[model samples]
Target chain A: MSWITDEMRGIVGKVMREAVSHPIALSDIRKWAMAVYWPEPLPRQYWDEDYAAQFGGIVAPEDFNPFAWMAAKPTPDDPPVSMSAFRESELGVETPDYKAILLTEIRARHGAPMRPGDVIRCVWKISDYMEREGRMGLMLYTTLS
Target chain B: MGDPRTLAVGDEIPAFSREGTVHHWNRFAAVNYEFAGHHWDDDVARHEGFPAPFAMAPLLHAYLHAMLRQWAGPSARIAAVGIRLRSPFLKGCSMTAGGRITAVRTKAGETVAELELWMDDDTGARLSTGTATVAFPS
Candidate 1:
């Protein structure tokens, strides 16, 4: 059976934009760097106040915006659900019982450098969807921006 | 750091390797609010078809970025990045990130370098592959 129902495909162009609650912070950058095992003798730009002053105060790594804008998990009062999933339910399609939603691909583009205290706004859309066979069974491929 | 102008198409960027650790995974989960069991609980991961808790996709993507930015130095700017996750990177596996300069050109009067980046395990199996574009000062 095809997992890509017309209901799911109907919302392909839907877009959502929101302002993140908190500004990006220096500590967030540091934690991410540490988690990735960023090479030792950590860059002075991330920690040393004197060295960071050269770049208009402490500068985050160039790719740090994603972390800054990550959405917080929804609380019980606010269940997290995607627009496509909602539409699927409306069309009588049951949510799959899969244990994980794997990320098959990602594409990102950089804009302004995000620094400590900079408020971030994220905008994304459902670009496309398709169904294909997988090791388990049918797999759904969805693209977002 | 070598001058961007001196880099050739075949030049090899510096390689970076790190062993995945549970401590690192926990830190990433806390920082990113990624409470997914498959990334932290081995039992849940095994039930989900993974042998062990695996690294999150963004973590692996950031590792690639770290490799590129470290090789290019502090002044470099990454304009774009694209990645395809071919296989799971299990916990405690040693992963090495490296890339080769695929092309260099002047665009909009700025020198740009394109690289094909990848991560491989100690067994030489490719876990992920991607491409990145970085701009250098002229």
Candidate 2:
């Protein structure tokens, strides 16, 4: 799908202007964004590869999908209730049932390539979301959440 | 199989640090579609409460991912990563990414490590701080 439609772009432009003055609360936006971005939890098929790489000697760059994890959302066809079940299956654990939306890092850059004053609008949409159970523990899944 | 017990609590993962500049920031913005004029436009940043155009937040996160891969080598699973933004990352400013292991625990027979991270500017002023958990092999 074309991500840059006139309507979408217009909305993005409006948000850019308003973000400074009428900035949406991060939590609120995150909820909506999470609904689309991280619909549920990390899947076992995906997590297993990622888990193996971290604790075991297995390593593959393709195993990690930070962007996918942050941008995916559930489709209309997905059962909302199934999200929980999907997450538990991915972690392979039962306790703690970790459910958190964490913002982990920020790296400031200097001498940016764009002109020093150009305004850029960032518009993110959710692509998929679900839940999964893995080997680690009870994981409340949300790919981007 | 490598003895799972071989892993120790005091093990230190060497911190990987890198310097970033405006050129890098622009590249990140261009890719991420961060057309915010303040990101690369000096006048706009000043008008918008930033000293200069700053790097994109995602770029910062990507850098952290890179740092993790460098330190943990290829075998590292990022269980969860999060960051809270603080000061502006103005253009012409250089940033350094650093972190240290804070705790380690295993759940479901998996070894997970927690680390505290700091993304700072050239003068050592902190721009962001966060904790991340990752599972690594025994």
Ten-residue region with minimum lDDT total, candidate 2 chain A: A13-22
lDDT per residue as tens, model 1, B1-138: 636779789888899887777776776666666667888798998988888888878778777878877787767778888789988888878888888889999887668999998889887889989999988877
Screening candidate 1 with a backbone cut-off below 3 angstroms (N, C-alpha, C), the clashing residue pairs are: none
- Chain A TM-score vs. truth, each candidate: 0.73, 0.23
True contacts kept of each: 0.57, 0.16
DockQ of 2: 0.08
Best candidate, lDDT: 1
Q: Please give each candidate's TM-score.
A: 0.87, 0.49
Candidate 2 local lDDT, residue A53:
41
Instruction: Write one digit per residue (lDDT tens) for candidate 2, span B49-82.
Output: 5566776666666666556655664344566666
lDDT of 2 by residue, A1-145 (tens): 2212333323321211111112222232222222221223322222354554444422222212122212223322332322212222222222223432222233232122111123323323222333444333333322221
In Å, candidate 1's interface RMSD is: 3.2
